[model samples]
Target: MQEKLNQFNLLKKKSEKQVAIGLVIIVVATLLFLTMSSVGSEELGQMLGIIVGLIGGIVALVGAAGFSKVKRTFKTEVLSAFFSEVIPGTDYIPDRGLAPVEVYATEFLKRADRFHSEDLLKGKLDDVDFLSSDVRLEERHVQHTKNGTRVYYVPYFVGRVFRFTFNKEFEGYLQVLEAGSPLTNRDFQKVELESIDFNKKFKTYATTELSAFYVLTPDIMEAIFELEKRNPGRIGLSFAGENLYIAINNNKNTFEIKMFRTIDNAMMEGFKNDLMVIKDFIHTLKLNTKIFKRK
Candidate 1:
């Protein structure tokens, strides 16, 4: 992992230097264009300025592309190393994810016309079956302007989705959506929790009121609060059938390396602590022994 990080840092520096070269070229060309008229070479300067500026633009675009290439490679390489060394038996797919059929089956997230997912990881640890991937759902929106109609993808959700299957089975459907989130089903009736802060942060909906109350106990709510604090996104929890679905909406490509951001202890901690969230849920929610009963 450290070796991969070292390689990434080196590539990061190279990409930055390439981008800087492009920017410097553009700046120098602009300055030369401005001074050409003062140097009594306006016509020649105009031609040279145009040529040099175009070259700079191409260089800058190529350099920018290099940054993107570096990010993509870093995610695949460094994250692969993490999965192999840190979490054996776990499968990691950098360019693939859950099918649209599987995502829609959750019935807990908004369905969009455009859906993309990647960074698929699945494994069993301590009898807990888990699968997760980064998902982004976006609907197509058109903007009409003088430049004609421009198509834009408005994102509905961009974060990681987790699915866990335990021995226990839950009755009916209970959805705990973050407040202000737009995902909901007609079958679910909204219910309010006793904690004002919890209610303020999360909006609960369920087909079975008793089951909702039973599943979302005070301590569980507290645990969810703690989980929210640890994560950098909105939390969505659903208890349906025998699986627990968690959708975190932090709007981040979690695996991608930012070339501009320094790799520090805090950042390295996050990188090294990949997939610890699954363990946290197992311990905090007690999924290992989550059995249901009639109230």
Candidate 2:
């Protein structure tokens, strides 16, 4: 990690120098063009302006490319190393396509028309196999304009999605999402539980009321409430078959490396805390408790 940080520092310095040089060239060219416009021919001023623009564009592009390369290297080396430390045997793939993301969205999210996933982490933790990645779900919208119809994607959800194998298989689907107007499928009927506080905090939906009650026991409800209290953002959960999907909607780019910033203990500590939250999910929700079994 320290070695990667040193490399990042060197790359940042090089990038900054290139950007400063580019800015200096642009400033000098602008001044020269102004001076020429006052005393020299308009053609000379135009030529100088064109030359300066080209030079500035090239320099800026080079600087941006250098910074991008450094950022990718830092993420792959430093950030991934940090995650590996937090969760041993974790494999970080910078880009592993969007098939897993699509599966997560279709099976759990059930929202958004476009999806993109990256920075995948696949491994096992405490006998539980899991796949996690930074997922961005966007909804495509079309606007009728004077010129023509324009279609673009608007991001509705951006966060990390975790899919892991549960301890046992169940018969029906269960969803525990934030309390509000329904966002899940209509097939899942809303379930009213005995706890008023739990009802206020979250809304339970499942294919059968008995299934909801069976999974969300008193202890599990308390754990769910505690998890929600720890994380104030939107939490979406789905259980189907032997797999559990959790989508944390925090609008954060997890495990991202900043090129301009120096890697420090505080930053690394923050990464540890974030990863620990995911790690704790396994224990916090008591997912390993095999109460339900397939008949």
Candidate 3:
């Protein structure tokens, strides 16, 4: 009896079973009512038939629509919650009415506007307070530039007080943007943002965050952040997607993670062991340029 009850609970609430049952009843009633009526009542019989048919159709349509809405709502709410929990210093800023072409046009206009207005606007930085303390930072680290690339590294920690300034370009245009991005100008379009569906792949209570940076443009190199969090010791890395992906999660403070892809075989075979021997791990990250192309 308990198992049967669980099965019933799993059934979708707006199932068409009720509609189907109504339809069956309508059909049986129409046949019986028509057969029992007198021969001269043809017009009355036709009116009753049409009414019954319309009623049954409306019932089925309503039930189907209700079920569909339930399914959609369930999926959206779950995904929204998952992303909210995993992204640090991030909130759901939906890109409503933002298509690729619209985004491109807006970006182009922004650049053109800034270029045109540079002379018109004197130094306005003084007007901005920046609220530096309100600005949160997590981990902080410096990576040696290689191949004209800047790869900043941060531990798997979420911080509330790290600071890094960008060139006037970022300060100029990005400051105007509603969503502050970690990528530079040319690479802004290529910035990777991904969210995992834990419910889709596994019956787990946790969802994963996946974001990667590629070397397509110089600006992308700027996506790297130096984090200085409230609890530095809680930062850690988890292995996932083999050598293709590395995930850093901040378990101690807030539920947040940053995932990135790595170049294959970039590290020496004994690199982990060698770093352990020297009490250091690979302090830099590297990526290929081709990976960022639109998929």
RMSD (Cα, Å) for all candidates, in order, is 3.3, 3.1, 22.6
Q: Which candidate leads in lDDT?
A: 1
- Which residue runs of candidate 2 sit more than 4 Å off their true CA positions? 20-47, 97-108, 180-182, 290-295
Shift in Å, residue 175, candidate 3: 29
Each candidate's number of clashing pairs is: 0, 0, 11
What clash pairs does model 2 have? none
* Global CA lDDT computed for model 1: 0.79
- Per-candidate TM-scores read 0.85, 0.85, 0.26
Best by TM-score: 2
| 1-295 per-residue lDDT for model 3 (tens digits) | 2443233224444344655655775786588458646676777777777777677777767766655554344324432343334332222222121122222232212121111100000011212111011111234454666566564544322221111111111111221111222222332322223222211211111012212211112332222222112223222121112211111122222211111212122222222231121111112222222232233
- Which pairs clash in the backbone of model 1? none
lDDT (Cα, tens digit) per residue for candidate 2, span 1-295: 6776676788788987787788888888888788889986777987997799679868977997888787777777777777888799987787663465445543546566987888787888877778777888898999999999999998877887788777765688888888762378656788999999988878888989988888788987888888877875788778777777887788898766564567677778877777777678888877655555443
lDDT of 3 at 203: 16
Summarize candidate 1's per-residue lDDT along 169-235 as a digit string, tens digits: 5578888888887758657888888899999999899887787887888988998889888887788
